[model samples]
Target chain A: MNKGLIIAIVLIVAVVLFMTQSDKKEVSEPAMTKAPPPVQVEPSPAEPAAPEVSLQEAFEMNRAMYGKGHSFAWNGEQHTTDHPEEIEASKEATQANAEALLASAMAKNAEVAKLGFEWKLTGDILKKAQQSIDQGNFQQALNLAAQAKYHARIGIEQYHYAQANWHLSVPE
Target chain B: MKIIKTLALNLAVASASQAALAADSGFDMQTVDPEADRIALQNYFKARFPETEIADYVNGIYAVDAGSREQWEELEEFPPYEFDVEKGEELFNTPFANGKGYADCFENGGIGIRHKYPYWNKDEGTVKTLEQEINECRTDNDEEPLAWGKGAIAQISAYMAWTSRDKVFDIQIPADDERAKAAYLDGKKFFYAKRGQLNLSCANCHVQGTNIRIRADLPSPQLGHVTHFPVFRSKWGALGTLHRRYSGCHKDSRSKPLKPQTETFRNLEYFQSYMSNGLVANGPGARK
Candidate 1:
């Protein structure tokens, strides 16, 4: 073969070999790296994993949280007091706090009711709480109010969970 | 070239990760397709109860078990709601205080119209149920609106349903109206969404839990649920409308019941009636 022709042939063969190798790498590389990493679901803080709190536990928690006049937050509002002594010194002030808690429970119940997720006992419990208040039994009223609030909170959580997961129950 | 390859690989990996996340979340917000849903629901029951005839579903729990069906047939021979239907017929024909009566307001003097409701009223932009319209008819003619759930309302509904016996439900969600579609979707959401302290949806019992005993009673299949209404339940010992049954179910599930003829319930009836599209109306049924 002529010298120039032989050189050109060599270059062509080399180029074809390189192209073939590149195509092989392109096909095989994605396959090797295509295994998707396992997805980790971080439970939303706003959403409860399940309705785990019992009525008794909810009442006790509310008693500890509100009975001491300890400051706490719920539904994005801060329920607090600068004067703990004022709460302790005045029986009327304590009664007011109990009434306030009952009102809060009512508001929460109404929120869930709009979503059509209100529990049957929530309204009944709140009514009893109001009755207790009417009878001047502040402690009993507070307990019932706490229980009602618990039901309302759980209902709200259920509403959110259902919004996201309801389609799973749909028959395929 | 190496940089380009790395960028491509990274894009592929990111896409895969997003897909995996979506699968793990299992979040789906699908558009409302009533016809598709109806087919799936009917097919589900058919597959679930292969022996039960499709037409027999209007019989509810009795349709599932042969023993119960035999007893139900016996009960049917001396149907409990016969008296209610007769009273309903009288109430329906009696003229209102005004010169006009219920016959004046509806098509075909309101006979054989049970299956036509609960319909979407385009002008009202809401669902119009048979019971609701009955009350409206009374009020429109200078008469008092009847009490919902039971009593006169149920009696009237029973007479109307009797007139509609063997007529299949043909509820419509108008194609041109967004409100009608929204109402149906809302209702479907209500049916599937878990509520109350028990965390139970309507589907939990009637759909997935059909034929399964809950306490002493077996839950009925959701298919053809609306076919039989204004039932004379042995528990009540009186005739009651479908909303009465809905209220009872809510109480059973520990959820606060919505009032009868309310928007929520009217929409629910719209969805359920649509689901029972092909089934024959067999209302004023008797149940234990």
Candidate 2:
């Protein structure tokens, strides 16, 4: 092609590409911000095959899995309490844990409840203080807020202690 | 009839070989001892680097203990003694134009970190994983956050995890605060939220019906998920931050991926890590 003709063609092509890109951006900008349509995907294949285990292998695997999980029931139950001694020990431990958790939870509930009451009291105090202040008693209101702040601090401490105890009772 | 029987015999042998071939992958179902998985990780490393002796300093923790003891001491810091820590330190101090540093947000020079992670934020009513915490600090400081896979966040997370060696994770998200309560609730929801092509939630395998097969084995819920972020995974063939792991889960779910440091993932990390409280911190762990 002649130089002038080639240059003219190149310029036209560049203009066309730029126009197309701008058009695409204009079309896409609004769609970008909108909520996307729900996507429907094809279902996946069935699960991969499990390890082929003989009966003995399956039993051993189950035993290991159960052990890792700390599932200690043994009477045809979850655990391997094949021995009478294990059963007795497990039961005793379970009972102890249950008692401890119950006691701890009760204590926690009481502490948290006390804090909740304190918070309520603080709110009431603040309201009364606000009324007093509106009536031009700044000193009384200030005193009331100080008391409310004290109550709030106490509530926080109580809540923290209760929660800590609760945490201690529950094993990870 | 004779030809048909011969063909049948050949087919049977071929099928047996194929079955054996299928079972030959590194992870096999019947032989799955967690011990075996541990050994596989070892063999994989040995095969990858024949010269190096990767030492097992702590239980369930592995590191390349090559060179003299003094030289290995230098290697203890991750990114193989690169500008990783320095860049991380600079990134740590270089306050994004928004005027913030790691010290401003977290405790312990931002060291002894990972303790307050995976926290339930009752205010935002969501769990905030450590990754989310980092992203929160990054964004709050007016910086475009680092990508999760193998960048600044991973570098910093790795560095912090190294600094926090042998420390037990002790997160404190005040449940009494309304925000903390909300965060815990949201985190719990995320834990139970099912997604992916498999339609599995973290709780599905980790909690309820654990030990069911995905491929070989899935670790149980109690195995300290948060304690192993910035993990050097065999599957990934590279070091990755928790958010990268999150993104992998999302991709596995076939869900639209959230941005690194997005709220949903941060909350997910919070709930996941909360489940792993009391486990000793073991970040940048080598895993399959």
Question: Residue by residue across A1-40, what tens digits does model 1's lDDT show?
Answer: 7999999999999999999999987788767586778696
Worst 10 residues of 1 chain A by lDDT: A81-90
lDDT of 2 by residue, A25-143 (tens): 77888866766776855545575433355444554666566642244432233544122212222332233433332333334334534433233344556567556556665555555
User: Per model, how many backbone clashes are there?
Assistant: 0, 16
Q: What is the lDDT of candidate 1?
A: 0.81
lDDT of 1 by residue, B1-288 (tens): 665465346434533442332222212224567887888777777777888888888988998977777888899999999999999999988888777878888899999999898999999999999999999988877788888999999999999999999998888889999899889988887887888888888877787767765656778888888889989999999999999999999888899998988898888889888889989998979998
Q: State the weakest 10-residue window (summed lDDT) of model 2 chain B.
A: B25-34
Please report the interface RMSD of model 2 to 1 decimal.
Answer: 19.3
Regions of model 1 farther than 4 Å from truth: A1-93, B1-30
Off by over 4 Å in 2: A1-172, B1-101, B120-129, B133-142, B208-213, B216-222
**Tens digit of per-residue lDDT, candidate 2, span B137-196:** 888877777666687787677777767766776666573565653454455545544443
